[model samples]
Target: MSAVTVGQELASVPYDELIKNILLAMVAAQNEANASFIEGINDLVGTEVKIKYKEDSTEKEISGNALAFGILPTLLQIQSGIIEIKMAITLQQTREFQVGVKARMGFRVFSASVDAKYQNTYSYKVEGSSLVRIQVAPAPPPQPLMRAIEYIASKTAPTIP
Candidate 1:
């Protein structure tokens, strides 16, 4: 084997920075892959997750501050909801970690939906008009009172000598 000779040292990067870069890349990839889901999540944040039974059974929901959090939390909640969903999807292999499925009995099935959201305790509106309109209006005409104002004679009349 021939010995290699170099005049300058090789460039080195920090593990923390490398890890951060990898994490950012993974996050970006995840966002891209689940673009629609993310978009849906953003829109559905602050809304209720409702599960309804028979028409005679009335309604059920998870709402208020708990549901009004930001998109990330909402997405996480939705992710957690997979178990609540009880529907198997993306399963092909026998592996339990890779979106696999199994059969179960006596599990209740419910409808999931988004409800009107008034405000989120954990989230705020980031996009909207910030400038406030300054309005000025002329003061209202003085009203007649017992002693507040005296009716004066017309200016067109002159005082007699």
Candidate 2:
């Protein structure tokens, strides 16, 4: 019996379908990230900070949003939060053929006959990996939005006498 193996493309899974599924998952992840970022901004906006000072024979106190310290740096981080995902997939299929032969020899009337058989089998393997990277270098916030946050910060900031 002789066995032969041949490499072939995987028939069950297609690259396009795999990529489409990956894209769908990425969309869902992006949605979740958006929700989380919104929650973070809301929390930051609600946070409060205070400062106190003493003047000659007098005491004064000031109150402001926590972001008042540095709206540009604080909001820059929040608004710049971004993420990217990459994926690699490999699919393999193999076909193996096993051949068998049986022979009979006879001296009567010098007659000979032979019989042969072959069997084919298939096997499949799939390998996949993914990489995730986060990018925080998003473009700067719009001027109007920055101005508004700065205004809020200035209004809430504590005063020193």
Best by TM-score: 2
Candidate 2 total steric clashes: 2
Quantify all predictions' global Cα lDDT against the true fold. Answer: 0.30, 0.44
lDDT of 2 by residue, 40-148 (tens): 6556667766667777857777765656655333321334444543333333332323233111221111110111111122221112224444444334445775577
Q: What is candidate 2's local distance difference test score? A: 0.44
**Candidate 2 minimal-lDDT segment of 10 residues:** 106-115
Q: In model 2, which runs have C-alpha deviations exceeding 4 angstroms?
A: 1-15, 71-122, 125-161
Report per-prediction Cα RMSD to one decimal. 32.5, 18.5
Worst 10 residues of 1 by lDDT: 80-89
Cα deviation at 61, candidate 1, in Å, is: 27
The alpha-carbon lDDT assigned to residue 60 of candidate 1 equals 42
